[model samples]
Target: MKIANQISMKEIAKLCDVSVATVSRVINNNGRFSEETRKKVLDTIEKYQYNTNTVAKALRMKKSNTIGIIVPDISNEFFSTIVHGVESFFFEKGFSTIICNTGKSKEKEKVYLKTLDSKMVDGLICISGQEEIEASLLSRNIPIVTMDRRPKMTNNLAIIESDHSQGGYLATKHLIEKGCKNIIILTKKNRLSPDIDRMEGYKEALTEYGIPFTLQSIVETTDHPKGNFEAAREAIRQELESGRTFDGVFATNDWIALGVVKALSDFGKKVPDDVKVVGFDDITIVKYIETPLTTIRHDVEKLAEVTSKLFYQLLTEKDVLIKQKHIKIPVELIARKTT
Candidate 1:
């Protein structure tokens, strides 16, 4: 007759001949109770096989207690660190997290965003590479926080990012100070603002230091690990074939930097001895390489924490004025064996 299924907390309370409050207190271990009453409550509960409705409790709170994070690539250590930060913060607040990797595709990003929205997540943290989604769509109903990549058209979205321009300037200036005359920079074409700004900073450093800037030194490639490695190898081969010498190289990201290091090794060119190298985003693997990389370090964890706080504030606080907030975290250069 499915007696256990038919039984409930109320039925247990009735069976124990105790008030609901006493039964609930004993069950939750909240209030003091006589040993006799506690025993009776436990026996009744076990006999009934009563289960609490956690879903109903969450519904009453009007929140799913979950935050959705959308990132470009999970395989990258940079994104993984950011996820750690988000998870740490949300877990402390008794909230759960869901991570989605979009593989830097705008179509996939859009699909994930819509899917997470349908799942009724309390808030969303997006790290997007594209700027096609409308600002109105982001600002209309839900709270969305952007990390690493900023939305191009929106001032209404909250953005947490590192100072890429400063990082670039520092990296180029460091190379220049180390007596690198002919420097080459490898980056992606039509990059995001951070990349563009970094390139501008690199150019400015060269101009400031009286080094002649050449467009021929700029190499653009598709933004992928394999593509970057091939580009780095090709650039070195071309330079050698043309009988040209470059004293230093700067890559926009750490993966690209690692690729350049491999290319240089293959070509019998020593790092910091023959050609100094600098990379952005101090990914973990760089530290353990044959030549510890000299790279720009961003506080990815702090960015995630701030992003989570912003989402929570937007969701919890009524009459919250959403502003175009650009929070720029600092970047530092870690001098390693490479430089």
Candidate 2:
């Protein structure tokens, strides 16, 4: 017996010639449905205006068909591109993405995690977080994908990242080939695992070229994004003030490279003529810059595409038995006039 003015899901299913399960799948988006079937069902619902309003109330408790993407900093070009890629991919598959900008804060991250759980988000994608996800989120079998970050514990999770070590090697090696014997490597604020690997590559290049990997050759920055540019500039200025001579600079990102260039110019040094510069993550501006920054290029779109595919695989492939799966996207060096 149905309640007053209540039309059953069975009625709607029969009207559209699809099983109740198909309607449920369409509602939740956890399962697949043909475009034709989806249109038919939606059209029928619109035509009839199922009693008790949209679809059936019983079907509302299932998957939200929404994904939460937690990024450390959305302002960064790298992360913004990543968010765009993931959002575009999921939007086409009947899924909506809820983007949470943590601003690289541990407390904010914790808040987003608990909030997502409260909202019953189907899955989560964490991008470049310094802190690990709370183990409580992992207790449930929630599908997750992270970029260049490994959460504390995991079950069904996928990791995607660029080849940082190789990029660092290529950048440093190119600088060395350009006759830069004394080179300074400017590390990014809040260095992730990939950055650590990049540092290793920098060291490798120095070792191969018989250049000593001394403390003077490395300048480490902290977690303040707003201060990164000024900080890099100050570091270089200090190095110059201390009579420390460096013929080249390898900034972890293009933004930092800008600071390095300005600092060199402040001391009346000519770029490439007196001090060559290279950076990581060849952002769009690198090409048109006055010096045409040489940088390591990473494919953000590919990273997003692969991450979305891996996430869907984790969501659908129940028997695959995934454990700590990691995927690294290759990187290339965009050789410009900076080197």
Give the candidate number with the greatest TM-score.
Answer: 2
lDDT of 2 by residue, 1-339 (tens): 334356566877988888999976664433588978776766655556545233322234436677899998898889999899889988988887899999888888888987776555778999987647784743246788899786666566777899888888989999999999888899865677877888888999999989999876788765444677777888788788988888988898888898898899899999989999999998888899788999999988899889998887776565676554888899998888877
Candidate 2 segments whose C-alpha is farther than 4 A from its true place = 1-62, 137-139, 222-225, 322-324
Candidate lDDT (C-alpha), each: 0.76, 0.80
Which residue segments of model 1 deviate by more than 4 Å? 1-62, 134-140, 153-156, 223-227, 322-324
Per-candidate TM equals 0.76, 0.80
* lDDT against true structure, model 2: 0.80
Report the C-alpha displacement of residue 72, candidate 2, in angstroms. 1.7
**RMSD versus native structure for model 2:** 8.4
Question: Candidate 1: which pairs clash?
Answer: none
Tell me the tens digit of each residue's lDDT in model 1 across 97-132: 889898888878878776665455677777755755
